[model samples]
Target: MNFIESELLRIFVGEQEKLHHRPLYELLVSEALERGMAGATVFRGLLSFGLRHKVHTSKIFELAGELPMVIEIVDITEKIEEFLPVVEALLRDSGAQSLVTREAVRQWTT
Candidate 1:
């Protein structure tokens, strides 16, 4: 097995938020792909709150669009660092109240 030190980039946004009239998650994933990222994955969160501390929850049985969405991408630290400003710019351009974070990780290949 081969392993490398990596960085995990995580973006948090509301499901209803949009950029360029497109879903933010979709835009983020497309941007990552266009930047030649290792990969991007989006996860819908059940309950979440940030900044203003307003809670958002959407039960599976009910229809709701305010729930949180998380976009994750993992790659080498340099790639992730290079992508940070682009993510920030996108968020700013969208005027989205969002969160972006990064952490160290290990990626293994067999």
Candidate 2:
């Protein structure tokens, strides 16, 4: 067994946000893949809100059909740090705002 200290980047976004008419989530994962990162995961939330305090939910009516999306990527510190700016650029290009968090953790490897 082996383990190493890695960085985890968690991005909070909306399902409807798009970049060039494509889903933002798709682009996020694709970028991570292209970067040769260790791994990435996307989680769709049934209910969530951001700094704007606007609530989005799966109730269909509560959020007006919008749900929260979270993209999490884990990799080496250098990789994560390098990718951080890319994420910001995507958000800017899409004209959307999101919350991104990065932290350190132990990553297990085979």
Candidate 3:
């Protein structure tokens, strides 16, 4: 049950956000892998809101596909720091709204 110490970076964005007609989450994961990140994951939220305080969900009555999505990457502290600016630039260029958080992680691999 031993775990390795690492750093976790989480990015919150809307599912409908895209760049060059590509989903932002897919772009993020590709970028992370290309940069040799240890791992990256994307999660879709059933219901959520952001800075605008607008709610988005996957309910049958909803009119849009803009659900909340989160992309998470984990690696060493130095690597995460180095990648932060790159992520920021991507967000800026894409005109996407996102929230990023850094935290300590205990990871285990088989």
Q: Go through the candidates in order and give the C-alpha RMSD of each one to the true structure.
A: 1.8, 1.4, 1.7
Model 2, residue 75: C-alpha shift (Å) = 0.1
Clashing pairs counted in every model: 0, 0, 0
Pairing residues by index, what is the TM-score of model 1? Answer: 0.91
lDDT of 2: 0.89
Model 3 TM-score (2 dp)? 0.89
Per-residue lDDT tens digits of candidate 3, residues 17-58?
899999988898899999999999999988877777788878
lDDT tens readout by residue for model 1, 13-99: 888899889998889889899999988999999887777777777764453688888999999999998998889988999898788
TM-score of each: 0.91, 0.91, 0.89
How does candidate 2 fare on TM-score?
A: 0.91
Give the alpha-carbon lDDT of every model.
0.88, 0.89, 0.87
Candidate 2 lDDT by residue in tens digits, 1-50 = 79999999999888889998899989999999999999999999987776
Candidate 3: C-alpha lDDT: 0.87
Runs in model 3 lying further than 4 Å from the true structure: 60-63
